[model samples]
Target chain A: METSVLKSKLQSYRELALKGINHYVPKSEPRKHLYDLVMDYPSRGGKGFRPGLCISTCKAWGGNEETAINSATALELFHNAFLVHDDIEDGSEFRRNKPTMHEYNNIGIAINVGDAMNVLSIKPLMMNINILGPELTWQIFSEIEHMVRQSVEGQAMELGWRKENSKCLTEDDYLRMILKKTCWYTTIHPIRIGAIIGSKGKVNPDMFNRFGFFMGTAFQIQDDVLNLIADEKAYGKEIGGDILEGKRTLMLIDLIQKLKGSNKSKLINYLANCRNENQLDNASWVLDKMHEHGCIEYARKVSKHMAGAALKEFYTCFQNVEDSEDKDMIEALIMHMISRDY
Target chain B: METSVLKSKLQSYRELALKGINHYVPKSEPRKHLYDLVMDYPSRGGKGFRPGLCISTCKAWGGNEETAINSATALELFHNAFLVHDDIEDGSEFRRNKPTMHEYNNIGIAINVGDAMNVLSIKPLMMNINILGPELTWQIFSEIEHMVRQSVEGQAMELGWRKENSKCLTEDDYLRMILKKTCWYTTIHPIRIGAIIGSKGKVNPDMFNRFGFFMGTAFQIQDDVLNLIADEKAYGKEIGGDILEGKRTLMLIDLIQKLKGSNKSKLINYLANCRNENQLDNASWVLDKMHEHGCIEYARKVSKHMAGAALKEFYTCFQNVEDSEDKDMIEALIMHMISRDY
Candidate 1:
């Protein structure tokens, strides 16, 4: 019952996302070039997780769905905005198994489109001034600006680290980088913003932030593990893509520690050299060795452990909810995240 | 007495133009590299007519000098931001007849610098929270973003026109281009923002806006004239540079009308085939023909006419000032602009 409910809500949000983006462009434009740029990839149906969570959070805080929709649209726009630029910066030709924006169109126009989306993202909030005060408007903008600035800084720092073939970074450093680059923008920001608008600052919003950080981290680790064992056809992205880009995943770190001599050197060579399709066999061979060494499963256990921390908070919040049915639904959703293979 | 007083006030703005740019950059950066970028012949030691007018307009609106200074700094940075990108778009090797940013550094780093400067332009405004409200802050951002979008559109339009060799554009069309690319960002927006910040809904600011618009249009016309006759040595920029690039200035428009038959073909060849010493000679020959056709002097007269219209508005405002000394100073400044050759 919970699974069916989540699916319908996800579909509704997806349609709203399309409507939100389409409404921004002027009818006078000779052709709908910008909208066409966004909807070009049809296969990439989103899970709508960040936005769905945002909606749920807004409801959790007792904010009106209509009021929160503007914030949700902003989140969706920002999410795609980063995807556009990130694809270019990383020089990834494909996203969701289709050519990236810069690849499909030229780089110059892609850059323009990314910028336009970023601009359009804020237009929603700016237009909704009847509900916003001067302090709150500045508050939201300052938060977004810091998020974007830190994300860019994190990307630069990670690229610097990657250049050194840095597989030896401590877990603390890894957590800091991912939290800055992935979790903060992806989860906590959207959830907390939704909660704030819902409660209009009523609830203890700090707990939402704390739980979101761990859940997002757990989700990221799941993604990192999926890069190895996940079916290529189902994943809709290149297999071992992170290792191809020389990203220092937890599995890679563990594998490095377990191997030595020529085995280690060969693994490093495969990790560093993603271009040689002939060496892809060796890369896969290394992946198998990591599984055999218990490195991959060990990383998955860690992810589950982090997800457990998030579930603890969810149950605490659920116990205090006046509506038992909503509390039950929230717990079921949390359990699914921890248990689901996907 | 008023006319003389305005001259010194205008000069005062110029004398310290570089000081703020210097102060903002940390001393830890190689002094030579920093100096080389800012102190380049094209960028340095200018009249800063745009920023000067902005500062003066702010003062006239009863705003303090401190509030105006940061706004003026933002204006200068904004100007350089355009220059950074425009040089790349136009692809000429020089700016102010010296090497362009990309030529001095490289395209990648030059682009990064331009991006950094754009981001930095807003930091000063963040310091203005106490004086202005969120409504005003958002308005200013919208204005800047609007200007930038139009400028890029104008650039794309110009590129299309040049590529297709479209000669259908008129004097009105040229005005629209400059209005977007120059007048809006440089003058109109600054004036409106200053008024908005000062008045803060205190009073109707329509008169100040009209005053600024008229002055901005006049300032733009004067610049077009200077592009033709100013000494390259004194201006630190190329004379007839726009002509070489086939920019449809007012003089170029009149020249097209005046030079019938063979001179028209000669002008087109000189402009379209803009390369090498001999081609430059062809351009010079066309300029000589424009002089023979009296187009040069005709453009100068038109500029003076525009300047006169601006002066009329400026003078009316001057007469209304409560203090006679302020009246004198502003009138003096307007006269200085009218009389100056460069």
Candidate 2:
């Protein structure tokens, strides 16, 4: 598809996804307060990648857009739920370079607002039982629940390591944390949910699940790379934001292993007592060190490999369906996500 | 009805609720540290009335005690969820007059622990679906959802009043706040849940709802009174704690209404800035003035009336029931709650 056509389709889906969300919050005084609090954080802007992937991946498997949007709305809600709590956890005051919900609203009301959003995330599915049916509702709810647990588990693992002052961290550990925490929860659950519910629960679920896992991993690695090296103005989140927060991303871990002497000690100390003024400088130094050691190239290679592996998996399972359209859509989306210029 | 027998039941239920709660946490290495953060917060010492009401009310409606215990455990977990966030909001350093979960553990990990407990609250019901089934699970989940909404509403109302510099709060306004924020969510929901879920969810839900409402109001009033005049050592929480926090309990509202002159100004100013240690003496002096205004007696009367009304509601529906054993047990439990022998 042409860029303009693809962009327009994505725009339409964004409107549909927002509409799906607006209907659930209802126009009550109290409900509106909650709606504003939640949507404020996530809707400032989006590449709309999560919801788009949800729609396209479903279309890849011969699913329609409408069914995909409900799951997509949930994708957006779950994504923002992570945003709300993660912002609070990381103490990042900014999202889209604007003050985060908790920091702007103050933590108490923000906490309640987040709690309400989480519960409200399920409300749409509950109310849509007539449209979605109880069985599909249960499946979607279960998928969302499983994703939350995995993300939280991944976070806990990272926090545990961060607290214990342990530097025995490895690339394997970093990958596992990112995969469990970010990968599938963001990608697979949304895709699998779209596929499963769009199929009206007729899909075997396992194929979508496998497809989501590989794609989601690819999606997460790209995100880590972008945080280190993307144009901050376009991304709207700071390029070195993760380093400022001492996040245990692949780039940081890889750089640590490859750097030597005072460079390594400086990076370690900067991470340990990280303050705002020094964070970006430290992040830049670490990035340069990683490049010097070829770790940046190595990280890029890993990201491509993950995306390629997922594309290979998609082809191995469904490429020979005798319909070129479905295969073309899958391959196009995979290519676009993996190679898109942000 | 004897003290020893009541003690045994409370003790037994507490033991079982703990065991069941431990089982729900699920031993995953990554998440165990987070679980430990929740487990260590004043563990093994809730009075268990919330859970007890769940099971007890269920039993009163002709259901088994085990399901009551399960429902009770669920309520306990959910309440802890509210407390964790509330503590952070209120800057509460202590719970049960000891270090609160967040203060004992850092806020980040404690936030996750509380969320896990909240999530775990519903998991036990899923496990109990074999005994209670899907319909009942839906009912319990719905009831829990409603309580969460009301609690948010209540919190909003209190924060609204606190932000208002005007000193024109009525007893009615205070009562409404407590009803939604503290009473219904804390006491009534658990009571009704225990009762309804007890009859295996086939009980006279209407009767239990009213019973829980009255009892919940009574419980809040008693808590208000206890906050003012209860024995510091025996009560296990500091006296005049509500007044110090500038919380709009019935006792403080009554005193604020009836007072005039320097005392009124003192109370108002103390409330506006009572958050500091330097304000403690003035805050205590204001509490003393509240005692002089008979605010304490007024609060105590309101509490007794609510409890009496709750008992009347329980009695009116079940007076003609055929089971003498259940009738006696119900009578015994209600007495123990209202009585202040210590």
Candidate 3:
């Protein structure tokens, strides 16, 4: 359960998944604009959380690493694809310590690259048929179908909220949004898919839902917190980006609910301004208000509670499975969610 | 097939596919920005060439109407998704006589809606499980996977060409680009899928590839010609928009190849300018040159040749199959391709 051990385990799984991802990305023509850009975000080191969860859960459930590699690679590709489009949608400037795809290239090229990544991801899933048989492969496809639908629906909610600049969001709304947006693909489906592959589709995937929801939400909260507090170098994203984009993180929602009258109106007006405009002064003011109102501290406390629930659910979900290093890694992952710096 | 009869048959097929597409689009919350937008391009009353080809081929191969609906619907959804993103990428102002999605909504919302449409398309494919069983459904998924990959690669080629403003493009290059971009999804896979379903996977889908390529390229060439000459109201798109976008159509390439000295430099400069800039005089001048240099007539001649080849291919590909209305309709559709104004 030591931090170094978990980090190494995650690193190893990431390398394996990256290898699979690289193999799938066609190194043919149109290299400069298309295939090369498809490799950009994936090559920029992510924590590999999705792939780690999928491969580790599969290993923990008595499947060999090979059986899950294609699925794991597909998950990584999908994750990177989402990040590429998400960066464009959020108007993000930095990713993994580099200019975002849309910033480095033009928006059109970036969008097409994201689309190519989506198309490339399908190859790995199709490869799953040879290893997992048609029935299980089809099940994985269905799981992917649900994962994509939920993620988009969740994205629609958040994008809609920002467009409307809704100031009346609540904790429950935040939870539901993250569950659909962050949890389903990031945690729930990865775990369910890994387990399904590992257990040959015998294990009930529904059993992992609550565990993934709690774990994934906690991870997302911590990520939001890290965006505000972590070193810009370590975080690999611009600090206060969520604020600039007016993302309705739990802390922002809590701050909205707590503030009143003039201060609240000022915050609302600040958010209403175009993201392209200069809003540094207003952004810093909002951050200062968040600190003064204990929004950051409140979010951290809620994240810890979610992590605790994840731990409990993790035990129930994996109680019948035999213990192994992968299981230990997964447990360590849950514990590490609340403690990591980035 | 009489012109009116062909029109009615195409309309009926389009209606059937639209019904299937509507049944798949969820009527849930987040309707305005997400699900509603997902239906926007589909409901814009496209020609339904893809669905019609797919359904008719299926019926011609002795398959029932019910068996082909899901695949046809999925193809239409994919087509619409492509249009939504294509409008954004091309910076197009109008689509089907209305503002492009990105023009009506912001680019961010437009991109997300396109992503949602891509996600929604998967449902119908997955629904194929009970009806077609697992193996054939997997085959269809593989077809879709190839279709999408080819389409994106083709798009990347076109986008890259515009980005570089390359003037030395050849007829072969144009053919290669549209083969991947237009033929694969627009014609090849649809017919292949239909034949596969109709014959219960016994037919060779590859046999339709040349037929599709010839038919689809001819169809695209005529479309380009119509973009310049079709009645504004009947065409449902801005006349000369392709010139504004600096699209590397056959006529444009022909014009480039034929022009000399100052006129060539002038055309290159005109193309190098931003699409947002006013290029009315330059566009008209280029169109005038295309006429004087016989570029438009050259393209029309090429289209007729391709259409002739497609007709020959149609006979060869369908030689073994029994005579039916669907088969005759397909022949009429090919004949209609190089003839229609819209």
Candidate 4:
């Protein structure tokens, strides 16, 4: 698919998902503290990767857009909910080039708003019962259950790593963390849910797991890369945020492994600065080291390899399914993940 | 219906529900930051009124204890999750005679733990598919969905009221807030859920709403009263903590209404200190004013009347059901809510 075509397709999916999200958020009183804030993150114009992936996969597997809209919207809401909490967890100041929900509001209101978003997400799934029937609705619920658990478990792993500041982390650990944290909800489950809904629960969702894992890991690595290199206007978040937060990206792990003696200790001390003092200088130093040690280049190569594998797995998973624009969109999305400048 | 009998029944039900909660909490890696903290609030030994109400109501409606256990456990987990976040929102220092989760750990860890708890609560509901079947399982999910929404809405109302510092609040506002916040989830839904399961979704759950609302409001008022007067050891929380948080309790509103001139301004100024300065002196002054202005007495009377109405509504709601220990336990539980010193 042409890049313009892909962008338009993503825009359409995001619009549909946003409509579904707005329908669920109550417009009653207490708007300022809760409901309005619940809509804030969704309205901030996310790429809608989750909803797009879900809807396209559903269509690819023969389901109509209506059958998938509610679940797609739920995925978008869940994504926003996670981002709200993740921002607070990471003490991130910006989201989508705007102040984070917690930063704009107080922690108390932000926490409550995130919670309200979570509660609101359930409405879409419950509505699925009427459209999809109880059996299929229950299946969707089960899919969401696993998605949420995996996401939180992944979050727990990442948070634990940051808290302990474990320097001796491995590539396998990074992969495992991303698989649980980013892959399941972000890519794997969206596809699984869409396919299940489209195929009427006949498709073996496990077939998409490997494809999603490879694609999601690559997507996450690319996201980290963009955080370091993308233009401030295009990235929609503060550059080098991962470094200041001491996020354990692949580049950070590789850089840690490469440094020796005083250099290694300096990197360790920078990582240990949990209070985030002198963040600009420290982040710049770490970013420079990542370049000098070829960490960023190494991450890019790994991401490319993963994307290549995802393409292979994608073909394997979708071989029997009939071809359509939706299928093409999925392939293009994978390519976009690695190839996009922003 | 003896108080001691009710105590023992509550104890048994609490133990059963805690076992279920423990079963659902993952015992995997990332123990310190997530799972262990997920278990912390439950392990602090809550009164388990929610689970008790749910289980007994189910049995009273002819449901087996085994059938109601999972839903009851889910309710308990949700209650703990709310408490975790509530403590953070309220800036509470202590709970169950110990430091709040956010106080013991950090905000990020506490928030994530609460999120994890919320995620874990879904497992029991999903497990309901086998025991209750998909149709009934979906009903339970719907019930939980509404319970969560109502609770959050109610929380939003309270949080908004505090944020605006509205001094001209009314009794009606208090009732509406409690109805959404405390009554639905704490009392109403548990009874509705249990009755639904016991009767196999045949009973009209709405019939119990009034009973639940009245009982829940009364329970909340009594809880507020206890926050001022209950023994430090018996209450398991710091006395007058609500005053320090500037919570817009009924007593505070009543005291505001009665005070004149500088006294009224003084009280307003005291409540306006969102930063909680001079907490000890301010909380003490507010408590004394509540006593002098008959605020606590007025609240007590309102609570008693509500409890009396709950008793009447209880008979009307449960009139046709057969009498059993479970039925008696529920009646005793209502009485216990108003009459208990603790």
TM-score of chain B of each: 0.84, 0.91, 0.99, 0.98
lDDT of 4 by residue, A1-342 (tens): 998999899989999999999998887877877888888899989787899999999999999899999999999999999999999999999898899987877888888888888888999998998899877887888899889988888898888889888899999999999999999999999999999999998998899999999999999999999999999888889998999999999999999999999999999998899455866887899999999989999999999999999999999999998999999999999989988877
Candidate 4 lDDT, B1-342, residue by residue in tens: 778888888988988999999998877877877888888889988788999999999999999899999999999999999999999988899899899999978888888889888888999988988899877888888899999988888898888888778799999999999999899899999999999999999998999999999999999999999998999888898888888888888898888889999988888888788454766777788799899889999999999999999999999999999999999999888879998877
Candidate 2 Cα deviation (angstroms), residue B299: 2.1
Off by more than 4 A, model 4? B276-278
Chain A TM-score for predicted structure 4: 0.99
- Measured against the true structure, the TM-scores of the candidates, in listed sequence, are 0.72, 0.90, 0.98, 0.98
lDDT of 2 by residue, B84-171 (tens): 8787766666567677766766666666666666667767755666678778877776787778777877776675566454478897
- State candidate 4's DockQ: 0.80
Which predicted model would earn the best DockQ? 3
Candidate 3 whole-model C-alpha lDDT, 0 to 1: 0.92
Candidate 1 regions exceeding 4 Å error are: A1-4, A28-45, A96-98, A132-138, A159-170, A221-302, A316-319, A323-342, B1-53, B69-127, B133-174, B200-319, B322-342
Error of 2 at A301 (Å): 2.6
Interface Cα root-mean-square deviation for all models:
5.0, 2.0, 0.9, 1.0
DockQ of each: 0.13, 0.46, 0.81, 0.80
Candidate with top TM-score is 3
Clashing pairs in 2: B51-B72, B54-B194, B55-B68, B57-B195, B58-B195
